[model samples]
Target: MSLQLPDVVETYFAISNGGDLSQLASCFCSDATVFDENKTHEGLAAIEAWQHEVRQAFDFEVEPLQALQEQGQLTVLTHLAGNFPGSPIRLNQVFRLEDDRIRSLEITPC
Candidate 1:
């Protein structure tokens, strides 16, 4: 079944919290692109690879504080905390969904 933006976001949180790569891949479009402060990943292959790399680098949880849909984008404010001092990073996760999957994702530290 096709999922809404919120559903996709929730799935991402679940998969991330669980560190489940397979589950995480399900939420992205076949041609999805994800961008973070360091790098950009394109397509399902790159996204999955990047997910694996990120999961290994950080032990954290992305807790969504606010989620809203505006102008074809889903914007979320989240708190990220884990193996770092003052790590509870506040960030924005903005997503663009296409065909019920995430087509683009941009994360910015806030």
Candidate 2:
């Protein structure tokens, strides 16, 4: 079944997949933060830089397998495959949206 996602969230996945990184400003709030790999990236510039580093290092594809949203937070279970040590793995991405834009996101092992 196709999971329904909010417009901003959909745009986020689109950007992550193949869309232009310049479009990130439209998808994330100026103060957005992303936590991954034990590092916290704050602000759009930092988030973009983090994305660039991860995309360059892993070249991974992320597919959302399941999702649940409560209040302003959405948690998605994703399958990732790439050049990393583990060819494939599952992770949980928790996103907090504010004013229709992503305010924060935390990625952790499932």
Candidate 3:
């Protein structure tokens, strides 16, 4: 089934697919956090840096397939393909949003 995501989540995917770090950074709150690759990046600056590093290191695209919301969190299943070790993979991106901004996000293999 297709999931109807929040505006913030939709914006996140849009900016991410566009590959605009600056616009992506604007999708989060000042104290937002991102958990990926066993690392936690906190705050906007760190998030921007992490995005920059990852974007530069791998040429990739993310296609959000579905989303599920529980409590205050939303988990989205996405298909990612890139130049990384595993060329293509499916992952779950969990997002916690507050005040129309993403407060935290965690990504894991699906």
- Identify the leading candidate in terms of TM-score: 2
Stretches of candidate 3 off by over 4 Å are: 1-3
Model 1, runs deviating above 4 Å: 1-5, 84-86
Residue 21 local lDDT, model 1: 80
Clashes of each: 0, 0, 0
lDDT of 1 by residue, 1-110 (tens): 22344777778878777657887567998888999876899889998888787777878877888877889999888888988567989999999988767899999998
Using lDDT as the measure, name the better of candidate 1 and candidate 2: 2
TM-score of each: 0.87, 0.93, 0.91
Q: By summed lDDT, which 10 consecutive residues of candidate 2 come out lowest?
A: 53-62
lDDT of each: 0.82, 0.86, 0.86
TM match of model 1 to true structure: 0.87
2 or 3, greater by TM-score: 2
Per-residue lDDT of candidate 2, residues 29-88 (tens digit): 999899998999999999999878877876777888899998869998888888889669
Total backbone collisions, model 2: 0
- Show pairs that collide, candidate 1: none
